[model samples]
Target: MLSLKKIAIPMLTLLLVVSAIGLTNAAPSTQAIETLNIGFMQAPSSTGDFGVRLAIDQINREGGIVGPDGALYRLQVVYPNRPPFAPDGVPDAVTSLVAQKAIAIIGPVDNRLAFPNLEVLAQAEVPVLTLATTDALTELDPSDNIMRIRAADRFYNEGLATVLIDERAITSFALIQTDVDSTEALLGFEGILVNRSLTPTVKIQEIDNSNLQADAERILQGAPAAVVMWGPPEDAETLLLRLRENGFTGLFVYRDAQEAVRSGAIPISLARGMMGATSWSYTTPTELGRAFLVDYVTSFNSIPTGVEAAAYDAVWILRRQIEQTGGDITKLREGLLQTPTIYAVQGRLEPSTYGGGDFSRAVTVYTMGDLGGPQLVARFANNVRLGDDDLVATDVRVVGLAGTLTYTPSPSPTPTLTPIPSATPSEVTLTVPQESVNLRAGPGTEYEIVGQLQLGDTATVIGSNADFTWLVINHEGQTVWVAADIVDVFDPGNLLSQLPIVQPGTNNPGIEPGQLSEGIDLTIEGVVLSPPQISPGQPFTVQVTVRNLGVNAAGSFSVSAILQPGNLTITAGSTGLGAGQSAIVTLNGTVDGTGSYTSSITVDATNAVLESNENNNVFPLTYVSDRPILSRIDFVQIPVGTAFDFAGGTADMIWTGTQIEGQNNARFGIVYAGAFEAVDYNAIDPSVVINFILPGSNIGTGSLIGFITAEGRRGVMRVDSLVGTALTVSYRVYSN
Candidate 1:
């Protein structure tokens, strides 16, 4: 929740300024005062919002933008009441901003939040200044409204690859994708390498931190000259630590290594000599960038990151365009496109040939200094035009004295073809025996199916579960898991023990399950909701199992369950627990929300008990009411050939969710039922069968349809209106 002081202070100051203006103007004036609402998607205290607020204040102080109609428009920042990453939060925030008549929107900086809601923001028909660096956003935007303020990930990928291949002269490289967001980075880097007539020695995709050790071992086996990774800072740090611990001496490069070091996820000692790339750096040589850094630091009492710089630049750019266009909302996009370039804090803002909205092409490569800071090594202006399949980077140059550093390759033993009689085989393979086996995302049936292997299809095994119940295999270049029972082991050398134990998608670091810790370590083993689905305001019990895995005993500690949106808090406490002891703490609470509520359970709410790792104390449990959650899709007009994914909660053609398209997850074209009237939400049963076939051309307004999501949750859709190929509908999805 945003604090009143944070929002009210600026508004109050604006009010006083307006009042002063009115008092001072004794004579009648032709100019009328209006408010220009600017929507911000991040939290009020976030760096992006801070930059926006500062810009808004400055604009208001300068008497705001003057329209051609002779009206003074004051800038006012608006934020969604909900957190940006929450379910439906982005769309809901966009709706709120549209209602406020916002001329522009700035940031939902995270790629995960921004990518899915591109259509929602585009539908608003307002310029959205996005700080997210994912290159896919340029391709994903349905409208020209999404303007990227920062250089896309491909720039960083290109810059990092240049440093590794050109400077280090590393031919053999290993690429690691640590998360879903890293897919584009991994592919972009690989493409750059392939274009340079070099192939990656190893490619590890979607490697979770739980399987970091295994993936590190795989990288070591490849023995590439350098390893380039892209992922979250925490996962990158974990993998780097593991790789280093396993005696890996190869050059390590990650695009987010600076971020990892700043967040203290990776220590400076470990990050020393490692290379990274970023869109912008505080050590920028540009005059405008230097001034921005000074002003931002003086105002906020902190050095600004790339997000802050992008936000500040975005606001200023919008102001300039608005002033030029006379505050005409419809002309903003045209004005931006017609303008050749605008010099701002992030260097030259020129329209990208790849996408209309991508303005900057700046990328900076840096290496960690011995004094625990980033030392600029090189800078690049990536100009690989899109649609031509050109992966070559242009305007690349080395920067600063650090660029002179030379790389010395680690000595390696020559490979031998002769097999040792008693040694285990270096590789293991698996083949599906009788029927097709599902390749899942994790090591369990609950995990989503990513792909499938037919009978006799073979794949090299990379990892396995603790008991080898599920084997991780490279299926069609994707790392997926297959049940060991369904696959026949082709290891004649009996080297099953060589496979590294992996728990995919799990984040339990440093401590394994059922393993005791050296010091006080409290962890939540499991959470069970007595009635998983209940009516709104219905009381429920949350049973959380807390175990002290530490060898040392823990003193008095408390457990709490806080339900979000309603903030319903329930707590229970324990006197003391011995080492290796377990206790079940039950918390009773009633939530008021009709939709989904995430209860965050904390083992030590007040920090009364010290634990070895505090990261595992908080656990999230999502439970929904039995009553269906209602969502409205209004006035969405899509082309006839396109499809809408209901689970994505948008009218966009893209399927952003994990549900496999055309399979269990059917789009609008596959799941449309025949016309029916007066749809009853509660009457629709979860098991009610719906015809899964293409709808007739005559289906239009007043049509009631029932459908099931890929997750097997049933829902009913009611058509409100239809015009040509455009259709408007409302849906109610059941929790069960």
Candidate 2:
């Protein structure tokens, strides 16, 4: 529990009376009286708080949250020790933190744990400092106060993309998600690629691995560059071992970095160089990183991982906010809006691309080697390219991916099934001895002629249409029929020649999976579900979804909304049924949107999934546009030293401009530092726009300024030296 002691100043007359009565010594005044309480919510067993606590104390120790001569303050740290957070159980600690009157709380270490109590935090206006796992909890923008300190899931997924291009030589991909929502959000990856016209050759599937052999058979049929897997490490280990033992040696990509490390999914030697995306930049701006290392060692008595460091950043950021705003929420919001670029051990916290809000944070790419080891950062880029090859090795040199993994099977799956039918019959024509012949249904005459066979209709003679029956001379076409006993006949064409057809269902164009191909407008959602086991009866359930919103079902009726699971297979992506009808389809994929992820259906369809009625199909897409919303500089890409003029005004910001959201998938980039300037630092006014909130002076339609955005409505965007936040969303759209 925190120590928040409210000192009551006795009446001045009483004090004078006490002084006169010589009771002054008994009432020696108390110091650190206006105890400022900050909440710290975290898993009971988590060590992440060690660093966070230290950071909070350190910042406070220097000068509390007060100015040089302003009223100084003290903070009492409270741990709502609830449950085995790193272990299990709904974190009762979150409730405890709220009870403690903590202005800002930090550390739940994992997404799953943080999500359950979002409502509680939202009601309290207490922001969450993300400590661990990109469980999609941080992104669901419930309130401006619920900010995250951790790097998000997009980085890991994006880093995986870079890994495929560099180490795996992946030109094409077939992304296979499991029944986990955190991983399914990858559908936005294509949206990220498409805004720039990059197309990934891919096949995305949702699977029912009831029969691994059968599932494997289907997946193996379509060879891909590499398979992107987003399941638990344990499940991945099982799947990878099975696929590898089954002889799938192609590149196998792991979603979360730790998953790969634990499962040993890839070559141990190549482990370090593995690309991972996360808001926590494990290796960037090495100075803050090195200092954090020393402090972490001293405080925790052990080394901290990027995830842990991220949690620490969350707490520090909160402490900073509290100090800057003097514990007033009005200042808290404004300060957050005006925040400057923050470079903690974790990646920088910039704005998101969606509507300029604190909901979105920047995602930085990292290469994880080993704990306590130097990790490197991959520079930002539109998409990973060839010249970037050297950049990969430089980031995390510990795991040197020396060679490329080209999928050329030593003994590829070559099905040598020579199905030669047991019998080979000859084609024949017949003539009748008599004027007319009867056509029997059966060759032996036991069967009757159900219908008449016309002459020149090329019906099989079959011993005559009817056994022992006589046929009249055919019509004036000059064709004659023979008597049943008079006709001579032989073999007939094989009765059947067509393959069995798979029943068709209504079609829906979901998030299509492939390599960066020409960007196709897609509707994608973020969801959380259970791990899909190849064997049934795993007590699996998927709950909570946040989707890209839109209208206009694109495909035909009776066709299914397909899901493709890659190395970790889901189901088929394409289903051809009748047209214009709806059906329900349960897919197994992952949900890894940047921050805001909740339990709701990603898409609305008869068969695909049923989203909550409250949701208006909000897909994660955003854009910056207006006649003068953006500024076009005199010269583009001008030298850094050149001065530029940017008109300033309030322009419309459509984080996702499309009427329907999420079709235009975007990867929001932010560059703003949390700040509030222009007036005296102590001025606390909501009406005054923070310096960072202003996008360039007057940019044309395409550019935007600082407005923290999520994949949905927030992230970081820089406007000149004054960095800001912006959002990149993948929204769906109907016919305009």
Candidate 3:
């Protein structure tokens, strides 16, 4: 979905520059090319390595740069291990680089790790092109020795606000952050909303290992439209997983922490649909950008991250400065300060000397992709270019005065003057490339493959995804879509805008059961029996009703009566039935012992009949099989609130105390009204009440406790002790 504004350069020309750079030679130097020391920490593992290396390799292949003394110079990169979070590791590493006469440094990508090393580099007066996002990092040196190629924290905040408000139109969201710098980043984003005169409620919280789940719950309670997070990669990823587990389905705005989310810390399913902002993305549009992607992947077997892309541009920027100043360090510094803009792979590169200056191509908003990697959704260009009124509130510090160092407006960079192609309304068409392309039911690969567009096949555009990465085409009146990359658009004018911007799967969310139209309709109407109650070992006759409501005749289906204790017998069944027909089937069953038996009558016992409503094809009959009558027993003496070792001593049920019992206590008893029957006991709901009375204690009026007897039968006892001299407890029990 991301649309980049770029110069209309030929793709072939761009490719040649990217791939054939090494073959071209710069003016030859008189002296042996001088080597400039540049340092990198965690070399191969660092995100900035590939870009830096790729750029340097290309420059060296082009005969490097000529120095002021007519000698050519090439960059010599030194790697020192600076394990993350080591207190003195980064400073020591930078010191070592300085001792090696390193002119400038490319990175320490992490803000926390990069922060502590700033003072050391500043004191050494060595300008660093860091990838860290902390806004305060730039303010560390008054002379501006640090030229940040990545967007500062505040710019990322602005980018988030831009996406939430300008693009998504979301009014309310939750804000979560971790680590120390998150506070400043969160505040900056809040300022953007306030400036727009919109005060939508925001639920703000801090999260860490201990409160990750709890804080996620708190955020979910707000029912936010989305959640914005700022933190270290790990912390950010942890919170994202927690939110998903708690069913927090809303937009997720991750800031400058893609490294963590993309690190496979979260399951791919849960990670899908997550959105984030970054300074650079591997899915760049330019041909040069494509070259970097292919070269990096082939070389490293991994995706190049935003940090690496910024470092890549940093090398080129430094290389250009070196060429202009002929390797004079002081002159190079001046050139870096004075240059308005330098075009590179990330588009126009702009750095500022002002406080908290912004970088031009800083923030791109992207969503987690289904097939692989990120799907760029939108881009929020840096609005705070130098001499652009310094938009957004920033603290101004005048470093000098009249006849001294005075504050003055820095000159604006020369804007690239290539004419942007204009779109004219015309018929839109797409041509498949040299290979067969899959046409899917939706825009993403997650959608089902509906058809294929062969090489050179052309289709008229009906719609497209918002990102412009996919095109919806009509193939023989069937709606299908294809990826926009492998196809060329042949719009007469600009017809892409006329198509509807539809999201994948939006039109086909789901189908309901009632929507199904192709299946037989069958139902168990009712069950009738002659003499529903009988003594133990007695037999009963049952009649069942079944109906076929489908359009076609129902297939041969068997109906069977299954007794609860585990006996099954085929009863009256139908070989076939025409639409709107009903049949009565008969079943016979005998109970082995006295108890309540459930006669379950099911049509299509083997599931041979595909019914429209399978759930309604079964019916149940509760038949009572009472036991032989038994004599009642009278209660002699039992203590109230005392345990009763009943049920053959296998279990205990009693009013142990007057204290209310918790629902979880298995021994708690309840009373129910009615004379208990062995066949009807299972029908009674256990009401935990008094089961026994204390000696000489009067039984409370209207008291009853329904319980199971020691013989595994249900029983009910009623005491008439409220008026009698002795306790009188009568019981009626039944076998289950």
- Candidate 3's TM-score reads 0.48
**TM-scores vs. true structure, each candidate:** 0.50, 0.42, 0.48
Candidate 2, residue 414: the lDDT equals: 17
lDDT for every model?
0.62, 0.37, 0.56
Give one digit per residue, the lDDT tens place, for model 1 in 1-736.
1111111122112111121232123212334345577888755555587678666655543335555444455566766544354325688777766666778888778687777777776666577888888776766765778888888887888877777777778899988987786777788888999899999888989745677778988999999888888877777788888888888898889877777788788899899988987777787666456555655665566667777778877787776566556567789877765544455666555663435678777777889888777888877665432321212212121000001111111112111111011121335667665458898756778766778888657677766777989887655534567888766665423335434454432333223346677788887755656444445667877666677878889999999977754777789998888886666677887766454445678899799887887877877776555453433322222213223444433222221121212234433332333432223333454444443443444245666656665566556666555544334455545455
**What lDDT does model 3 reach?**
0.56
lDDT of 3 by residue, 1-736 (tens): 0111112223323221221122134323223335586666543334576677666655543345544344456665555432233435677777766666677877777676667777765555466777777777777666666667787777767766776787679877787777565777787777787898865355454644567777787887888888887766666678788877788788877754456556755555766777877776887564445655665666457788888777777787777666557555677766677655444555455555333433444567778776446777665556432222322212221110011111111122111111111122234667664458998755678766768888657776756777889887657545567899777665423336534454332222122234323457766644545443444566766655565656667878888877754464646667887664556666777655445556567788888888776776777666555553233333312222223333233323333223212111222234543433332444334544323332223235445545554344455555533332222244444434
Stretches of candidate 3 off by over 4 Å are: 1-30, 42-44, 81-84, 198-202, 205-207, 256-258, 352-361, 384-736
Clashes of 2: 179
